[model samples]
Each structure stands twice: as structure tokens, then as C-alpha cells.
Target: MNRPTTLALTFLTLTLAACGRPASTPAVSTDDTSSGSVADAGGHGAGGNGAAGHGDHALAAPGPDRSRLPSRAVLGPATVAPGLRVQTLPANVQPNLLALKVLILSSGPSDYGIGTARALLDQSGIPYDVLDASRTPLDTAALIAPDGSGRYQGVILTDSALIMDAGNGTYPSALDSAEWDTLFEYERTFRVRQLALYGAPGSVPEDYGLRYVAGAETATTSLRLNAAGQAVFSDLKGAAIPVTYSYTYPSALQSVPGVSTQVLATDPSGRVLAATSTSADGRERLILTSAQNPYLTHSQLLGRGLAQWLTRGVHLGEHRRFLQVDIDDVFLEGDHLTSALTLTAPFRLSGSDLLNVRTQQDRLRSNYPAAPNFRYALMFNGGGANTAVPTLCTNSPWLTRDLLSSVARCLNTQFDWVNHTLDHQRMDVMPLSTATTQIQQNLSVGTKLGLNMSRASLVTGEHSGLGFMDPTDDGTRNDDGTAGPKQDLGLGRSNPNLLSAAVSSGVTYLASDHSVASQWDAQCPTCGVPHPLNPGVFLVPRWPNSVAYHVTTPDEATAFYNSLYGPGGLFPYWDRNLTYAEFLDRESDQALTHILNGTPFPHFMHQPNLRQYAGGKSLATDWVQAALVKYSTYSKLPLNTLRWDDLGAQVRRHTAEVKASAAGTLSGTWNRSAGTVRLTSSAGTVPVTLSGASSGTLYGTDRAARYDLSGSLDVPVTPR
Candidate 1:
């Protein structure tokens, strides 16, 4: 294929922009061109600079005084019923094997740390049983099996001491002296590690070799990870992580014989925020003095490490950050908004625009090490491509379509390609023959263009044909000449002809809109919803963003955004019209939540969003890059990108595992000495993730492997 000089010039411009060159002026007039730097976007740099050291003397300089700030709710005094005393257990009670499960001890359901602890375990897919100390009585049976095998490998306490308010002006220990001794005895016998989600330093129920130095400090505090913390949380790259909206207790380590205290995290004053203590009897415990919730940045950053430490780097389920963007209507023309805020039809991406996108993709991967595997998935319409034109670049100005087709063919392997039908027609009411042709003809066209496309995946136009629209249309259309007010009629009303056509065309994964309630699998939030009409095809939901399909420039996007969300507009949520930068900030924040939560849903945008607005940036890439930059501030975990087929299979496996877990049919045991994990399921195949094991992806310092088990299976592992 002949290389166009325009393509080469566009690449040069993009390369210059990527290398910190000054951005070119926008082709269209914009209301605001002040795209703020990533550092100034949010509180991302709150802990960028802080003292990094080890040992008790590793103190940070005192931060700004916030003594006048109101203190957060503090733990009431810990007291047991009068005359309660510790009880001793038999020395011969020892366990040889333990199950790879966790036991969470919480004061009650209202305990804040309960949610925080559960979030960590849930996201990592680790199995855990919770017992309310205030309600449930602890016994040796709960700790050990009949065969002398321990039931849990680790224990998580809502706080250092399970103290509860007795509603009579006294805060009492939910687990009295005897109960506490029972738990400690189990830990001493089984050698299982324990983690306290929150703690107040003192010798109330137990001493962690810490003395309280200060009460709750409610402010954003920068915490530096000490040597012990770095070893436990190996993924953290020795940077200070900000802890916000937390009730913190800064403490000092006290000298205790036969007990070694290692400070994990410390505040500016060198006071402890998190620490680990090992007793003479080999019982180990990790305690964090700060309160945590799932939404906090500190919690998200520390959760995986905490879970790994709790389970000794062996657990069920997997935690992976996924971010995939699917651009729909790739070869087709979409509507565009003019500088005058008028909507116009027939706006297609030029060959130069494609080259700029390719350059930006490479730049993003190079710039953000965490997102090195990122690539865009293009959903294309075959009817819009001009295959009849010569593959070589031509001088004819009217052959823009030919130029686009030629460029796409040349760079076909750079991106993932998916079928978006032939004419981009809605299949809600299409006949079987028409639907089949729309599905198969597109595959043929993709094959003809040498595109690396898959027949197992398909993205129907507007995510139609999956039965989520108004049943009674009244034969009316909207201003855009499309059906109005689509209501979710549920998957039962899905078009049979379309389903059959897709099945015959070998389509296994069908794209659906996540905004539609009926399109997603409610049982397993991260799994693909199996179509009720056709079991062969699964509905893989795609997240939608704020970028409109019709806007090609920032000015147009800003104008359209203001009309819907600005003051005196349709939604009127914002006080004033947001600039393009502010708009991106809000949009990226939503995406960041999904990225942090390990959600694998791919976000969908339109072809117009691929336009290189300015500075070699497009609306689609900007949103993604913004989220990635923010994520980099807190985590170093790689963001996973999967093809459509692989994503579908992952969803299916995850669904099976969830079902098996819920049914209590999945179980596993880890033999420490043998360095092997044996997993078994009474029912169908279930996916089990084991850290420090052989096989699967390498996450952080441990290699987490997933095993699909139907019967019993043994996997060799290196215990951490």
C-alpha cells in the first residue's frame, strides 16, 4: 500500500505532542482550552512527598496543625463483665492441616470495619465466614474440624478488641476473657496470622506492644511505608500513600519481653499508623490504627496487600484491574455538532485521524507502565467501507473513503476488531434472513480487508436485538429519527430471529448496554448474562460514557453537554456549564471506580469520539488516560485487557465459581509443608485462585494461578 504524505505528517505531529511539544490550536473554537495537568486534577498528589525510611526513628516532619478539627468517634473503654478471667486450653489440642479460608470477627453488623474487611476479601474472591461477637458465642468447634484440621487459615477482627456498647453507659468486650483466650489458643495452635482492621493501642483485651499517644486525628494524613510494610505490601513502590477521612490513632511502640514489634506505617511525627507484633508463642498479628471504608483511596491501595498478608498469599478468587474501550461504528459515518451548536449528519473519521489514534495508543502504553497492554476494540460496519477503491493512496480528494479503507487494512493488526453489522441497522424487528446476512456479510467484509476479526463476538447496532425496548412504540420516532424512550422489557422479549441468526453465524458473545437493567447478570455482577432465549450466546455488557456520539470537537461536546446537564437545561445537575476539562474529570472519576474495583466491563464510545481534537488527544483516549494517571498514584497493579472471546470465557468461569461458592460445594486445603493446594468441588467446574503457586498471571510479588476444578486437584505452590 502507498504511504500518504498526510499520514506521515500526522504521525510527526502526534510524536511531537507525545514528547512534550506544545499542542496545536483546536480546529474548532472551544469555550475552554485549559486542560488541567493530571497532577492538579484531584487530590492525587496529596502524599507524593513524604519521609521514606525504616525503624522507629524514621519520623516525618510535623504537618500543618489541625488540632482544632473535631475528632472522629472514638472507641469506648474496653471492659469485660465483672470477675471474668482467662481460661486455658489443653496443650495437646493441635491441628495438622488448615483450610484456606478466613474467619471475620465483628462487633456487629453496624461495625464500620466489617464492610472494610469484607470489601478486601470480596474483591480478592477469598472465602470468609463472619461471626458477630455480640450475638454469637465462640466455641472450639468453630475453630477446628472433627479431624483436628483448622477451619480457617487466618482471622480478621473488626478492631483490635471487639468492644461493644452495652447500652447502659458501659462499653464491654463482646468476647469476654475466656472467649478471647479461646481465639488466642486457636491461633497459637494453628499458627494462623490475624489482622485487625482498626485498633486503639492499649492493653485492653490484648497488648500489641503499642501505647496510645494521641486520640483520633481527622485529616488527610500521609503515611510512609516502613521496611516491614514494604515487605508485606510488596506491590507498593515505597511511595507515601495518603489516608483520608479516617479516624487515626498515632501510637508509640512499647518495650515488651519476648514480643517483637515492627512498625509498618507511620505518620509525620513517627507515631505508628500500622504495625505487626509477634508474640513469644509465635502468634502474629497486624493492626492498623486508622479506620477504613471501601471507598477511601487508602483502603483500595492497602486492601489487596492486606488480604494477601492475611491469607499468606494463598486464596480463592482473583483480583485484576481491567479496562477495555470499544469504539462503535468504526467504518460508518456518525452525526457531528458544528461550532454554532447545530447537529449535522455524515461525519466519518479520516485516514489522518486513524494514524493519530494509533500514535496516541502507543504513547499511552509507553507513558503509563501500569496500562502497557491497553488497546482499543473497534466495532466496524462493513457497508460503510469502500473495498472497491485501490489499496494505494490516491491524489483524488473525493476518495477519502478509499484512503480510510487503505489505512485500516495496513494497520488492521494494531487493534482488536469486532462485528458491528453490515449497515448498522437495528435488529429489533429484522427477519431471520436479514439478520443472518447482516451478521455473516460483515464477517466476510472484515475477512476481505484482512482485519483480525472474530466470528464468536458481535456488537449489534445500538445494542439492539437483546429485547430491551418499549413494547408499545405507538409508531413514533424521535427528532434523531430513532425510536424514543426504550424501556427494558427483559430478555424474555428478545428477538428470536436475531438470536437464531447469531447462533447460526457462530456468535457466542453479544454486546449489550450496561445501563439497561435487563442486559446484565444480576446474580454475578462481573459475569456475562446468559441469554434466556439462546444459551449459546452470552450478553456481555458494555459501560457507556458521557461523550456523545455526534460530537467531533471539544467545543461541540461542551455545547451539547451544557444543553443537557448545565443550569436551566434538561437535567440541570450542575450549577453552570462545565468546561471540557472539568467534564473529563467527572467522567474519569466514574471510570476510576470501576478500574479500582476490578470490574471487567468494557466501555463503549462512538466513532466521532476518535477525532484528534487537539494535542494529539481524543475524547476517548483522554478519558482513559485520565483514569490511568489517577490509578498510578495509588497502585502499581497491571490493568488487564482481554479480547471479546476471552472475556466471555472468563465471565462464564467466574459465574460458575460464584454459584459453586454460594452452594457451599467449593472447598480447598493448603498444606504448608508439602507446598501444595488441593481444591475440590462437589458440583460443576469452579475457578480457584492460589497465590505463590505455579501457573497463571504474576501479580505483585506472588504469582496467582486460577484452577478450574471439577473433581479434586492438587497444585504445587511456594508458600509465602
Candidate 2:
């Protein structure tokens, strides 16, 4: 006889795999002493002559003129820097119709100017058009609208020489008098905004009224923000942001009369590092010390803040919350496997097993009666029951004929099929060819079985094969709960070959094993929101939970504890005998920590979770249900079960919206009318919570049974 579901839950040890290697040394170039030239950097036209009318000699050179320049206030000759002077811009109601488009001015290929600019903008999901000012010069036709209406609302100058001649910088070519006049005239007339990351000496012309004096080269600098600066630097408000510039330069501003200028940040010596200015035409201009890379948090935040400022609290679309729950180690059940091994191995759960699992899943649906579907991502390993043909069972009884196919048909149609690898091998240990082949082979097998396994999500076998996060404890087990000697598996470094193989196999969202490093952040490669980590690949992580590797009876549990926690054992302080109740308590605590973060909940489980043991005889279903119950009761927000791919897509869109929206802006508007709750957002997708509508029919802009923000911006929820 089996115990009731309530009492069947038990604690499991953390599941971990170990591989050891020396830590890798990051490559540091001693040769990058100076910024690359625009010509050498590969800007579109560093060496070529620009379009016919925008040539260098198109107009005669003009003498320097400062009569119309903004008033200059030089207070930096003193010891201590004055309070930050920043002019915050008012919210612009004139919506940017071309919110996705931006103008990128680069002089050379991957030059620090354009290269750094591209990296910053890549994660914002905003598209851009590049005009290599070096090769093709800027003329009145390109800078000003034919009908006097500006063609571009904003411009990012990677190469400073675009507006003025920075002889010592990347592009040495100076713009003609006509070009310079055209550029300044368009900005002042059209109110087009601009962000200048860096400039060579004399690069900032008097027309802009900025005196930039290049400082000594340094690797790092501390940047302090002021009150006015906080409003524009919303992401870094109330906090000092440290910036890393390959070559740090100290600069000062010559305040122009009648123009509002504010200092956003100051350097260590009390010099202005970042500042914003407002033109007479109400246009905004931002200048930074140097071009920053996206790898740094401050840099990413700066890029996002700039986008929101330029767009004035608008994004690609609305916002939507995504939840992706993955069930790992799905395989045919086998006989004689240890309870612990079973959790990680296979079991021949007959077709009836599928039905019973479905029955328990239905129970979960009952709680959210209004939700149209409950789905799971089955992360499968392909080595189980390897047959010449795609057969599930090859025994005399043939308990599971065409097992995977039948199982697929029985599962909820919305469930996702993820590739867990062909033989469940640690991808990091295998050769690139083998790793690539394993993923491809598994995908092929699933397709042959009509499983329609997608290549989007890869849950690398055994503690994330390409190790991004390794357990903090030593690899050995002890008698007490205390750990053994600390172990280090050179997992800190990313494997380029393995990543390339994963990308080739069509993996976009790769799962990571979460750590307690941060309250909410887990250890996933380039985790958090989607950025340009590996082009299209987005790394996602699962909260860490203790794993069970063996079946445990009260006596076995005692033995298990004594073996690992007893005196001189791996861990010596733990209780000699661990109870099932204690296990559940610990698991609950771990799950709660993550749930409170209120982001996506991607609880992971393995095959043995469905074993007849591990409490409740349906360990997998029991664990999942337990999680759902906790999430439903404790989370402040509503929850939706989405496939892994869909969840990735949602994150990508949400990141864009959050970057584009102003601080404290709500996702969208919800209007309840005629017994229907209508949802709408100017952004992309809106995650609308529908309470007391468990029995309601959710309708999106389309007629889909489920309510997904991607399908339509406006979704109507009506009672069934």
C-alpha cells in the first residue's frame, strides 16, 4: 500500500556532476593602447569618397566662429567639482512612429565608435541604419528633409569627425563648410536628438559649444551622478555607476548662454564625465566620456536608459509575463534502477502511466479553471531503448509499442519537446563533433518518432554539460551535512566550440542551473533578459533544488544520512537521520526564495521523479503539483504555463519594453466592459491578470482558445 499524496513527499539530495580542470586565464591585450582609426576599423566608407554631393571639398573651408556658440562656464579650474548640472527633458507626447529605427553614423568597420555603439544597441532590439560618414560624406540632402521635415528623429555619432574634423581620431577627413552648416542647421531646426560617446581633440566644434580635452589613458573610473542627472540616468539613479573605458579621457564643458546644461556624472578628480543639454528647439543631446561595451551592467543600463530617453517612454509594444516549466530526464522506465538512479534514468511506464500522469495534470488545471491550457516542456534524452526503428519497446510483451508517439498523442498539445542530447553525455567533455552530432541525432530520432521535437531549448545533461554554474560544495559525500574539500571545475570560462555546436544545432534558449549568488539571479550564460550574447542564443536558468539519487526508506534514509553526515564523513553537522518531511520543508524553502522574485518559474524535474517511490508513487506529478500550489498561493501575480520557446520570446519582448518605458510606467491599460475584461497596450505584449475568471473564455485579437499577448494586443476575457 502507498502513502497518501500529502505524506509521500520527501527530501532529495542535490544532483550534481563533476569535471575538473584548471581555471582559464582571460586574454588581455597589451597592444590596445589607443582607439583604432576609422579607416582601419572598417566603417562603411573610411577610405572611399562619399556620395556625389557630400564630398570633402563640396564647399570652401570656413574659419572658426564662436559668436553664435552657447555661453561657456569654466569652473573646473578649482580643486573640488561643483554640484552636477543636468537638464532633464520633459516627456514628449509626439510619439515616434519609427520607434524601431535609428541612425548609426560610423566611419570604419567595427571601429571602437560604431562597434561599441552597435553592441550597446543590439540588446535594445532597436533596428538602425548606418551611414559611414568617412566613405560617404553627409550633405544637405542626407542631413535635412527635402520638404523641411527631418528624416531622422535622432542620431548616434560613433565617429566624432562626422560633425567636425577630429584630425587625430579615427576619421581624419574634415567635413566641408556646407556639410558642417547643414548638420548643425538640421539638429537645431528639426529638434533631432544626439548621443556622443567620445570625441577627439577639436572634434566637438564650437557650434556644439563643448570643449573636450582628452585625458590620460586609464582602465577604470568612478562616475558620480547628481539629482538632475538621476532623472535622465533613471536606471542608475541613486547609485554611482563605474564605467570601464579602454582609454579614459577627462573632459569639460563650456556652458552656452540661453541653453540649459546639466552635469550627469563627475570623474574622480571632480570633472564632468557624463552630461546632458537641451537646445533652443527643445532637442536633447547627451555626451559620454567614452564608448562603452555591453558586457558591463552599467554599460547595458546606459544603453537602455538612452533608448527610453530618446523614445520618451515608448517600446516596440506591450508586456506579457511568461512561465516555462521543464520536465527533464523523460525516458522509458527501466527495472532494478536505484530510486536515485531512477530519478535520473529510464522507466518503462506503460501507456497507462501516461494516462495516470495526464489525470494528475488535469488536477492542476482544476485549480485555474479559466486557464485554457497547462503545458510542460519534456526535455528528453535519446539513448533509452535505442532501436533500429523508432520503437518504444522491443521486448516480448512490448508493453510500450511506439511509446514516444503514443505518449505524444496523449500529452497536452501545447507541451514542448526539447533536446536533452542523444546519449545524455556532458557536452563540455565531448569533442565538438560529438557534441554537435549528439544534439542532431537526438533531434532526428524525435522527428522520426513523430514527436516534433524543437531545437529551441537545450537542457544539457548532468549539471548543464557546458558548465556555467558549478556547485559550491566539494564533490565528495560525508557522514554529516557538512561538505568535503572545496572543488573547482573550470566552469567559469565559456567553451566557444561547444557554444558554436549548440548554435548550429538550433538552440536558442539554453537552460542554466541557478545559484544563490544573487537574490534573484541564477548562473546562466548571459542570463537575465535576452541580449546579443551569442547572436540569437538566449541563456535561461532554473532555480537550484536538492536532487534525490536513491530510493529512501526510513532505515535507508538514516543510512544515507550517516554515510554522508557522520563524523569524518563528507558533511559532519547534518542530522544523522533525515526525514521525508524535513526534505519537503527544505525543498519548499528553496522554491519560495525563487517564487518571491516574481519572474518566470521554470521548475525542473527528472525521470526518476515519476518512480513508484520517492513518496506518493508519482513523484514527478507530486513535485510539479506542489510547486504549482505554492506559486498560485504565494505569488502576487497571476501565472500562465508557456512553452520554453514562447517564454524566451516573451522575455525578449519584455526587455525591449522595459528599456523603452519610463520609470514606474505600467505595462498597459485594462478595461472591463460588458462582462469582458479588454486588455490593450501601446507596447508589444501585456501580461493581464484575470481573477475569478477561471471559467471564462479568453479571446485575444485572434480567436485562439488560449490568451497569449503575442497573438493580439487587445484580448477580451469573458465568462464561460
Candidate 3:
């Protein structure tokens, strides 16, 4: 791939009004709550910064025809060479233009722009349009008067030439002398929100009140959040984040005579690292530090927060966060029955063991209300050896088949169970036929054992860690008669056969992780544009730190769990070692971060956690109970413990809602009088989460109901 010419464009001179009268150095407040005040501008009955004419009433319908625009063109096949294959985005679904729309102006495929922005927007289910300036420089006239009127509510500029890509080496003179004069006038007169990265002086209208000033070449600098930034970025409310900056440009925004300005972050030397300014006409502009790339977690967080701020946090839905818990490797496996300092033979699962796990689950229930404490999701894999003929072991009065059936009966309840494949074989390494055996045999074994296997969501053994599909051999063999020329399948690149097999077998959910591959993969956590390959199937990445600890003794389990703490542990800042009491604190602190951020909490563990430890003590039970306490304590909102299958289904519906919202097929009106928010969509189902309502069902374009917050009734509307 070709590299971008520059990190970002220096500037794109625009002439809204001549250099504004110099204003005083605005008092920079250090309180994070300042951004909250700005957010209140979107509250009931405010039209300045809020979408024009949208007051407290939820339906801020722009006075325009509701006809859907032409869908985006479908991308051709995998024509790009191996590696760095960009998946073609699905054609844009025609949507209601009344929903807020954003346009991304870039300098072509090589421009390292909007990758992070797109990830953030897609994650929130917001729709945006892309304008490749390299193919065709921005049409300044149509930008301001597309169809003879302002067509976009917001704009993001990553390249300076987007305003005026004058082909010759000649530079545009003053702002008034440039062709962007009309662009600036429309921004001021119509109040279009914008987020610009690394632009030159006069690149944006002067009245907008933010200019990029290149910093003195220096080493990486740590950024301290000012009060305004605290309000915008939840993670930085009480913390300082560092972004390595050497050749990057820092920003300097001053409050114009009539505009309101807030400095969000400052370098050690107090140079503006980030800032936001709201114009007198309610046009808001947010500027951030220009650096190498914005794909890092910290960068993604900042960019995601910026998108939320730009949209006033209402494009997707009310700004609410959620948590989900998942448990993997659930099966009737052999375990040692110890007594009087002696070990017995292997056994499936004793009645005492089932009772112990149930007791632990009861402990989890004690922490929350009755219903929310039910069984979480379980990923099951029927042992291959025992599926055909039960293995004999002793658990006092329980052995092989009897013990397995008893355990299965204990777990038969309202729970979410997933197929983990037969004998835990990696499905990706197998062909379609082999993959079918692995999946079907497991379900078959589950049926014989009376285990709940109705759900067909496949977690895949080791999450397909064993490569996605066998390598195409060049008909060559190694010295040991092994095949040569093994190829690894990339998750982001095309894998049509795998997709075909999954859909053919009735699998609706697949596994993905939040790492590099996902950044571009069709089903990814950090993907630039997350989309499901199959219509009903959705790839849900496991929570980043979901751990699978292996240990045979109490001391080993303790040491293993503690090992995940400091240094290479999930949370390095937590230095406390694993003690019965101290482990709770350390794990709670770690889990608290996910909860406080409103991120989904899918804590994963294996089936062994339910078995007995030293002295017949159930360590898994204790560990799970402790985790439940911590997760429930800091999760902020009311707890809703869903099975993985239910959660995955909700996520699938939510993803559809997000895609349709971006396509402009969804819209809603907030009725303050009835204290309910109502939404309408072109599709039959729209999965929605009302602000404070714990549970309620919303479906289709005409469904209406008063959103109730007095009870826990805010569950998502599942499609019939």
C-alpha cells in the first residue's frame, strides 16, 4: 500500500468572515463537568447546538422529503492481492434523511484518515458518507448547496486540499481570495458541526476559532486532561493519557469575541493538545492532536468520544453502556474425587459438585435481585471419547453416565448454552465435512446426555486459534510425510467456505477478538466497518481479558489468577498478589474499569472452575461469586445477566439497528410529556435501549409506548 504524503493536511484556507476582531485569552476551566453543560444544550427545548429546530421534543425532523437515496454500490470480489485486503462495504441502505448524517472528506485510499473514526461510528451504529477527494476534489458549491440546500449536518476533514485542491503548485492567497469563501459562509449561516485534524491556519473559517500550530520538534509528550476533556472522555475524567508526539501538530484555539471556547487537554508545557469551540450560531468544532496514527486503543477511545461529542451523543440511542458475561468449556469432564488425603478414580461430576456450583450461583443471586442472578452463558463441548461410550469413574454414589445425566439435569433451566465443537477440535483447520462432524457430533452427544444444546452459536475450539482452514498444498510432502506450503487464512480477508459452512449448519454467532485482525475484518471489535458476512450470523469478539486459568491445586489456581495481575496481568496497575481476600479487591478493581466505561462485560471461564479444589472445596464457585459481586457493584446501571445466546441475539439485532441507522432507515422522537422515547424504522425490528428504562420492547416503524423507568422493563425488543 502507498503511504500517505503527510500525517494530516496543514490547512485549507476558508473565508467565512475576514480575520475576526482579536478576543481576550479565554479563562480555561479545569473542571470536567464543563462538557456536560455543553451536552445539556441538546436537552429538551434547545436548538442552538442541537439539530436545527429540534428542541426538547425527540422528533427533530428536518423539513425535507423522506425518500431514500440510492444505495451505495456493492464492491467487486477480492481483487486486491493477499494481505491488506479491504472488504467492500455493503451498499448503503436508503434511510430517512431526517436522521443526522456525517460526511468524511479524504484524499483517497492511501489517506490514513477516518479508519478510527469509522470504527467508532460503526460501533455506535451511526451512518456516515465518504467523499474521496483524490478521485474528485470536493465540490465546494454542492457541499454548501447540494440539491440547492445544506445536505449534511456534520463534516470531518482529514486533508487540507479538500477545500481547494489547486493542481498547480500555486497557493491560494488570503481567505477572501480563495474559492472556499462560500463554504465558510454556509458553515456560519447554517451551523454545521465539524471535527478537523491537522489543518493549517485559515484552512477553516477564522470565526470558527481553532488553528493548528505545529509544535517544536520534541519527544513524546504526556497529555493532561482539562475540565472540558474530562467531561468528554470518561476514561480521562481523573487520569492523564499520553500520546507520543514528535513531528505532530498541536492545536491553539482562542475564543472569538462572540464564540465560546474550551481547552480540553494540555501538554506539560500547557500547549493545547485538544480543544473544543462552539460558535455563536451553535456550530461546534473539536480539534485534537495530530500524530502518527489513531488505531491504538487510546486513540480509538479519543476518536470515539469525539464522534459522540460531535453528534451530541444521540445518533445511535441514548448514551447508555452495557455488560455481558460468558463462560466457555462447559462439559462433563473427568475429575478426581479426593478424601482423607487420598485421591480416587476419575469421575464425570458428583452430585455434591453440582450442589456446590448451584450454591455459588445462589451467592451470585444474593448480590443482585432474583432474576438477574440466573445462569450466564455456557459454551459446551461434548467429550468425544465419552459420547459413544460413557467413561467409568467414581464420585461416591455417582459414576460415568449417571453422574453426567445428574449434572445435566441440575443445569436444565433458563440458560444460554453454545456449541464448543466435539472433543474441542479446531473447526478452522478442518474442511467443511470435518467441521460438520465436529459440530454435529457434539450436539448429538449433548442430546444423548440430556444437556441443553438448542442454541447453535458456535464459539469454535480455541476460537479458531488453529488457523482458519487447511493450507492448499503444492502436492509436496515433508520428510515426515507432512504436507508442505501451509497457508494461514486471515479473518479480515475473504473466507467464503467458512462462512458458507457456518450458515449451512444454522450457526448464528461466531467468535472474533479485539486485536489487529479485527481492525479490518468483516466481524471485528475494532474493525473500521464491522459487518456480518452471513445475513443472520454475527461475529462477536470475546471481551479482551476473558481468561482461562488452568490449575489442579488451590495454591496453583491462586498463583495462576494472581499472575494475571501486575506486569503482564490484565491490569498491571494492580500490584496486589492473590490472597483469598486480596484477590477479590484486585479482581474487583480490574472488573470495575470495564463496568465504569459501560463496556460489555463477558467474563469467560472454563468448566473446571465448578469442580472441587483441595479438601473438596469448590474454588470455581468462590471465584465466580467474587467476580459477580465486583461486576454487579461497579456496573453502574441495573444488572441484566443474559445467557450468551440471548446476549448474542440482542447484539445481532442491535447491529442491524446500527447498520440501518447509518443507512438512514431509523428515526425516533423523544416525547418528554409522556416520559417515553419512540422510534420508527423501515425494517420490521429495531433493537433499542431507552435511557433509564431497565426494560421495554420497541419494534418496527410505528410501534409506540411510554418508556417506563419505574421498573426494570427496558429489555431490547427481540425480533419475532
lDDT for each candidate structure: 0.70, 0.44, 0.43
Q: Tell me the deviation in Å of residue 476 in model 3.
A: 20
TM-score of 2: 0.43
> Which tens-of-lDDT digit does each residue in 1-720 have in candidate 3?
110011000110011011111111111112111110110111111111111110000111111110110011011111111222222211331111222456676545434444544544554445667776446533444453323334454667653333322334332221222323444444555455677653332333344455545433233566677777867764333445545421234556655677777888877778776777776666678765543233222343365466656654434343223445455555534223232212234333344565555555665667654224556566666762244334332243334445544455446563466777665544333466656776777777667655665464777654553232235422121101112211234554434445566667777766643221331233323222233454555676554321222233455444544443335543232445556566544444344433333334354545545566544355555545555565443222344555666666655555555555555556443222343334566555555433223243222111112321221222222110
Residues 134-160, candidate 2: write the lDDT tens digits: 477666556433333344546787534
lDDT of 3 at 111: 40
lDDT of 1 by residue, 545-627 (tens): 66766678888777766665579644454778889888777666556655766767787777888988887989889888888
Stretches off by above 4 angstroms in model 1 are 1-74, 78-94, 162-174, 211-216, 256-258, 279-281, 338-342, 392-401, 427-431, 474-484, 521-523, 555-579, 582-586, 684-687, 694-697
> At residue 103, what lDDT does model 3 achieve?
69
Q: Lowest-scoring 10 consecutive residues by lDDT in candidate 2?
A: 52-61
Clash tally for model 3: 26
Candidate 2: which stretches are off by over 4 Å? 1-323, 332-352, 367-372, 385-414, 463-492, 516-533, 549-578, 614-617, 632-637, 656-720
**Which candidate number maximizes TM-score?**
1
